[model samples]
Target: MVIPVLAIVFTLYFFSTILNSPWTAQVSAFSLGSLLLLFCVIFVAKTVYQLRRGDGTLSFGNIVSRDDLASGRVGLFLATLGFTLLIDYLGFTLTTFLFLLVSMTILARGRGFMRITLVSALMALGGWAVFILAFDTRFPRGWFETTMKAVLANG
Candidate 1:
């Protein structure tokens, strides 16, 4: 319920901002926003009908709770924030590897660290190779990437 409301508001603001852009530049945003708004309207109507029928009630405690934040979710959120902020400095592959390793360690409760690290490293390297090498997608080159290139060149 709260998610849909936020999505509707976000879509409206996004549309407003993109309105001045050229058609080609705004087409994807316009299309996606239109669909989002349409679904939101339908959801709103259904939710209102359910409330009038006493079938559903909004509970702020359930929707946005301090307990959720207290239960290590805040740490996960902070971890994600850190990942996003440090990505340009760490580069995609290394950042993703560290993020996955940390998140798994946090959530896995007594899981073996070395096993998790190995798995994370394999997945991260595979993803980086696929996207950066095979597909030729461009990701930010930070200190790690630069050093790897230098080592490879020197070898």
Candidate 2:
């Protein structure tokens, strides 16, 4: 309730601040903001409905349990936080690959390597190709991708 309300308020403020931006930037920001707003609206409505039906309380009673904080949850949360901070080093494609692989591995206790590999490859390459082909925006290629490109170009 509170979080979504804040998100909705901040999103509107952000949209106001970006109204003068060019279409390319505005389109991306507008789309993302609209999506976020839509989700927030849905969440708010659901929360209200639950409250009316006496299904759940607004209180976040023990939501962040100590056991969860002490468990692998913390590791998972830290991994996600670090992934965002270090993504530019590996670029979107490779960073996404490693993030999905390691996150899924941790969640599933090391099972589903084949599934994870397939999904991660599809996401990374598909994202790269989409940006390169569609948007004409080749994202930051890390050292590994840069080297491969140079090698391929010379060969």
Candidate 3:
């Protein structure tokens, strides 16, 4: 159920992007639609497999474990939503770093503040260097727009 739900969500999101893009007029919408449809198919296949394994009597409750609900995984989903809101403003590296740090500490129960700090910093720097710096990727930057423009321009 979770996998199918995520697939549907991601499919909608990708479809949205294709719709919003300036090249939508030039590109074939069918291609994008078909690709997303593939995910839907995969979701159905997995769901059917689960149903068969359950002797045609599937329980939705069993899919998501009680321990998962009790843990801070629910909060992680909320954090993912929040991270998406912040991504445009903070840029991918900073936003991903912050999200990962919060997720690891809260949900994963990772110890050692120093380790988290180090890991987050390294991940942000590496992501920035590789994606934004080396590859010259152009991710949206709401607040850091000017700074990103300058750095990317220099590169």
Weakest 10 consecutive residues of candidate 3 by summed lDDT: 140-149
Q: Would you list the rank order by lDDT, best first?
A: 1, 2, 3
RMSD for all candidates, in order, please.
Answer: 5.0, 8.6, 8.6
Candidates in order have lDDT scores of 0.83, 0.79, 0.73
lDDT of 1 by residue, 1-155 (tens): 88899999899898888788999879999888899999999999999999999999978887558976656576677779989998988998899898888877776653799999999899988987787757857787666667766787799
Worst 10 residues of 2 by lDDT: 60-69
Cα error, residue 74 of model 1, in Å, equals: 5.0
- Write candidate 2's Cα lDDT for 21-117 as tens digits: 8887688889999999999999989988999999988764455566665455766787798789877798777887888777777776678899988
The CA-based lDDT of model 1 is what? 0.83
Clashing residue pairs found in predicted model 1: none
| Highest-scoring model, TM-score | 1
Give the Å shift of residue 104 in candidate 1.
0.9
Q: Over 4 Å off in model 2, which ranges?
A: 1-61, 66-73, 151-155
